[model samples]
Target: MKMRLEVLLVVTAVMCAAGKPLSKAAARNKLLLISFDGFRWDYDQDVDTPNLDQLAVDGVKAKYITPPMLTMTSPSHFTTITGRWVEDHEVVHNMMFNTSTNLKLPHKLTLTKSQWWDNGVLPLWITAQNQGLKTASFYFPGGAANYSGQVVNRVMVEPFNHPNANETEWRQNIDMVMRWFSEEDFHLVTLYYGEPDNVGHTKGPDHPDRKTIIQQIDRTIGYLRKAIDQHNLADSLNVIISSDHGMTTIKKRPLVDEIILNKYLNLLKLASFEILDYGGFGILTPQPGKEQEVFDALSNAPNLTVYKKNEIPESFHLAKSERLPPIVVVGDLGFNLNSRFIVYVNKGDHGFHNGEMDMKTIFRAFGPDFRRNFLSEPFDSIHIYPLMCKLLQIEPAPHNGSLTVTEEMLQLHSGGSQRAPVSVALPLLMLLTFSAL
Candidate 1:
């Protein structure tokens, strides 16, 4: 009896070892999450985008997804991947500012500061790595930071002053991501491009130059899909093309029309620190005893809405963080909240209230798992995190998204079956092993 039991145990071990390879093969499809920074939802509408049109025909396209409030780059991008509101993730702005020291870091320098990004929430890259899947982030916002001392399997931070309009460099990035998926076995990779956003800021969103950049981006999409085919990832890899937020033409003419804060309140006397002149958003810490006075002054400012931090509306999701100031100010659409009148160069800007139509962004998904030719109704950008988690077959950390919101975008296989459950497969495999022995 001992000899027979030993032989049966050996057979079971062999069967289990053989079955693992098959189980892993069937586990989940690889994901490529690409963010074209500042690519507006309707950008392709005016440009000749054969590739983008093809992508929409081949997979699912959202009407236009609403990004989280305070539609700045760092805040919006973090929300896209982590599925948390800007206040919830604590990456409340592109520039990291400390109210105590009045210290501020520019967007580039802030990219490397782990403390600015690692605050408790786990981004998709780190979460995937912890679950034994290889992941990478190539120039994606919040990609370079270490989350709780854990980093992505591979990371490439965009160098300072990196040219966003270099077409060749964009192709090279696509090739590298292909290698990450095909050669290095990366299960998920987040790639970013600083294109149309840069152009939109320099030239107005309606300018012909911005349209040209959109054309360039469309061509890059063609190159990306071709590279996927060349690398033999066409069948297995899932691709999501998306952006952080849309751009709007900045209202620069008629200086009187600008929302100048100094014109309304005495900043020096009433505020100890302030983050003003940042698009449509402003936050300030009141002087020790000037809280009510400061609030009343800005409350009556024209074209600007003032809110006490706790009194901020629930819809904006801008409250409930220590990083937030006691007083919050927002300008009307296309209006810049200026501290003083200066030569405002950028013809375009974002960081407005998300409810503005100009603040909505794009989302596209294509792969073996996604349904074909589906035009999905607009959904919140936060819902994307759960969709990605479901695609990777991984348990998502406590996120604010619900899979039910995005599950319909996926394809249901024959007999309504999608992936085979491991529990069912393992038992059947064990029975086969026992029968063979």
Candidate 2:
């Protein structure tokens, strides 16, 4: 009788545990985050972006989302997904330190499967994989096959170039994403379009051709939206449009004379200083005891803000990392960092901080689950990751910012009643000991 009673009790407990309700929200919707690189907010007025405008009317639009430091591709993209500054994530730029000594590091450091690890942070794809949700990326900068292994279900490598040469390649990227949406089950997807950014880099943000490219991208979004609706997937689909950074037009290209730089180099008794080619500038490490003299000379130069690595602005969040060079140089807006070997003929550059507004990018979210005809207080792009987790009904990882999903947006709210508290199960030994004594 005793053994039979025990068996019955075990069965009852198992049923109770199995029947327990989860504390998470129901993840019934799919998420798509699309990055239109170098897209400026003003472009909306310049071009007829009906789909994006519709998203704004049917969802929430945040007027500004400031890009994280260097305001470049690699770091800004990482910031959007990681919800942390590049200094914390350790992917400060497209090219980073390879460490003087070769030794295995954290999984995050392994930038590529083949190379030794370079970064030290996990991106959102890894987080989604941990939760057993399917994630996909279409030609995102950081989602290259070399870096995204088992973390992402599909990754397409499509480089940015003129549409004339890369139109077929670009179309292939769109076709692959559409096919995946039609065939596979994905919880999260990220798509990247690089034409506007490429054109802005070569021509300028205000270039007439940029408007044409914006229209092309808008048409692509229209096609995707139409496909979803035609397949009756609108209720379960969500779309987010954002950008890496904004672009500024340049009118003057500065020249750095080799003779002047060499004079300083000889006086400093440096073995050799590597001058970066093109308008992009870099200074190789100087011999010991000459670092200060080299920095002082650059500091006195016109149209430059020279800062020691530690003195980089707190707003930029670049002070904490060792990946930064000992001395950092920033050029004024509309100016490029030039070296003796090369000159910049055109006027357009990013990656340098002019001010907060100049570095701001666009953020828009639209879907059945989002709040419609609303706008939230401008927040950092880092908030997007946590917000995504919330929308997907996953336990949010600790983040530096709060995600505000207002009740009006969702059209639901608790009527001043406290939700029931939930208790997690204790280990068997602890439960047994605490049961009676």
Top lDDT: which candidate number?
1
**What lDDT does model 2 reach?**
0.63
* CA lDDT of each prediction against the hidden true structure: 0.85, 0.63
Q: Which stretches of candidate 2 lie over 4 Å from their true place?
A: 1-25, 96-118, 145-150, 159-172, 253-284, 354-356, 405-437
lDDT of 2 by residue, 362-423 (tens): 88877777767777666677778777776666765555545553333342222212332223
Which digits, one per residue and each the tens of the lDDT, describe model 1 over residues 36-140?
Answer: 888888988988989889988999999998889878889989998898887889998899989999988888889889999988999998888888889999999
The true-versus-predicted C-alpha distance at residue 300 of model 2, in Å, is 0.5
Best by TM-score: 1
Local error of candidate 1 at residue 77 (angstroms): 0.8
lDDT at 284, model 2: 41
